[model samples]
Target: MRTRTNGIQLLRNGERSVDKQYRGQRIFERLGNVSQAEAEDWLKQRQAAVDAQHANQLREGDEQLFAAAAAKYLTECQQRGVRTLETISYHVQILLPYIGGMRLRDVCNDSLEAFKDARVTEDGVKNITVNRSLEVVRTVLNRAARVWRTNGKPWLSTSPLIEMLDEKGQERPPRPISWGEQAGLISRLPAHLQRMVLYTVNTGARDDNVCGLRWDWEVPVPELQRSVFVIPSEHYKGKRPHVQVLNDVAWSVVQECRGMHDDYVFVYRRERVKNVEDEPVMPYDRIDTMNNTGYQAARKAAGLVGVRIHDLRHTFGQRLREAGVPEEDRALLLGHAIEGMPQHYATSTIARLVDLANSVTQTRDRTTLLRVING
Candidate 1:
């Protein structure tokens, strides 16, 4: 005989049993010799309990475990193709012990404070480090409230407020590279790295933009009698299109990189592993994302410990100012949206941008630049 128990079902199969959902989990219960009416009554009571739990009148019968929620969050991130999935997963593993079993409702200010203290006092973690972990946690919870849902109920009524610790003391001042330091640093780098650095400094492009640049994005501008890179709105920051006119020096680097790789404009030689297969292969067009750790040894050898690859962009912006390029023209050539202007500009604006780009193409002693790499 088949028996009903709320949304669950109970039937005779050599024993009396019921199947039901409890706290978002499927459970099988065996009630030996119990009547079908009894199982139905039990299920009704459980449903009432769940209602109370959701009403905040009880803490039992309904719980969202942190570990389970984290799994759901990671799945969403994977679907979105977040590049930091592996890194975030590693951090989640580290955080499991602190919050794996806690109910979602129990994640209050005190609980977060305790987690922070444990990380700082016992694990000796820095505040900034703790903040990054908190960022991942915050992101997961925010999605649960704002986007995640099941059966018309959001995983959370609202996302918890995550306050970031003040990092005033840890904030490093910006370092704009001088031409001489650029000369020295580039000389010590490998041929591929040298070109990447040179291209970045000249074009004012971020490391990711430089690395992710593809040949298909380049468009021939017959009006300007040359080609320019036009990064799509999605790829550029602020979701706006970025147009870059290749200066004389930067264009030379691109020409040399032609045919080196099938798609990417920049590629580095990856050394083979010792005795591991025939070759220790590395991915092409890859940027050392950990703040350029691979280039540290070369940077130190050049006696520039404080310099960073990002400073190359700053160098470009500064050089533009030094050369008396107007702010509006500089911003245009450097691929930033012109604020306070109509979305559409006159056709002559392209010529204006090209003129400003050529103005900065004037480098100090092209011979010195060529000699630095022994080219």
Candidate 2:
């Protein structure tokens, strides 16, 4: 007897049979008829041939090669603009030496674990440094897996294999200078650095802003009736241009520094102008170098410890808060992005900010007067 199995006729000869179509063709040609057993045997052989072909493809593990995948992954990263050339260079320089030759299929939990351990103990690097390097590697591999999935290839299956060391590496909190300390430090600093520190403290402007100050960027806001320093986007870390108000103290510093240079607005030892190439030379560089050297000397002279240049800005913020200036207004003066529900309120002018800053002294005077009268 013969029956249909998956659209092909199965037959039995002694132990196998030929397909009916083959038998038909044979009979038509006056050849011997094929038995059912022969047809069944031929079907099994065809299936076996397909299975062997698939097994051969499985053995050929060329797709998951690490070097090729990493190269292609880097190309994709560049194309997508996800990472910059400098950043990619760092990852390649640091990470490639460790796992560059390993195949993707060969990567396992133990391999990643060993790499992490070796990075810390063998290299004697900090845990934070090792963590950063591992993060780059993991990101690249995961990106590769994403690309593979899009192409309908087998996933790398090792994204979850890597583990990061648990260490929170954050910068230390800003240690602000007290009012008395600030005044003493300022008095002890050289004339140029004294102005810089005073300006930074009074206006809450960043070091870069004060250092990069130029006369061309100053603009007068009619509403505030005061001139403000307009910082260009290129010079700012936030990549946004901002207007900073110079207070009475800040204006005094600016006026004093004005005699130094009409063009640069600040200068140190008056280097003779040689050519047009010297036009964009930063005036604050010399002043800052002098300031740093003088600051250390001053710190030693005053017997103070742990005083940094940045503490001036922090001191400004802390003083504003202590003076009862509204937090929103303080953030605006400090050039911090406003947040929360109060950001919708009307924007205050520079004059108002100056007034608020002055109010701190007045409030203290009023409290002192009340205490004296009660006593």
Error of 2 at 151 (Å): 16
> Model 1 over residues 248-360: C-alpha lDDT tens digits?
77888888888777777877766665865664455565554424655687789888787677777767876777667888777766666767633333446666655665566
**Cα TM-score per model:** 0.68, 0.50
Candidate 2 Cα deviation (angstroms), residue 16: 87
Q: So what's the TM-score on candidate 2?
A: 0.50
User: Highest TM-score among the candidates is held by which one?
Assistant: 1
| 103-208 per-residue lDDT for model 2 (tens digits) | 6666555666777777778888777677776776666667655546634654564454567676655344566666566667878877767877888888777766
- lDDT, residue 215, model 1: 90
Model 1 TM-score on a 0 to 1 scale: 0.68
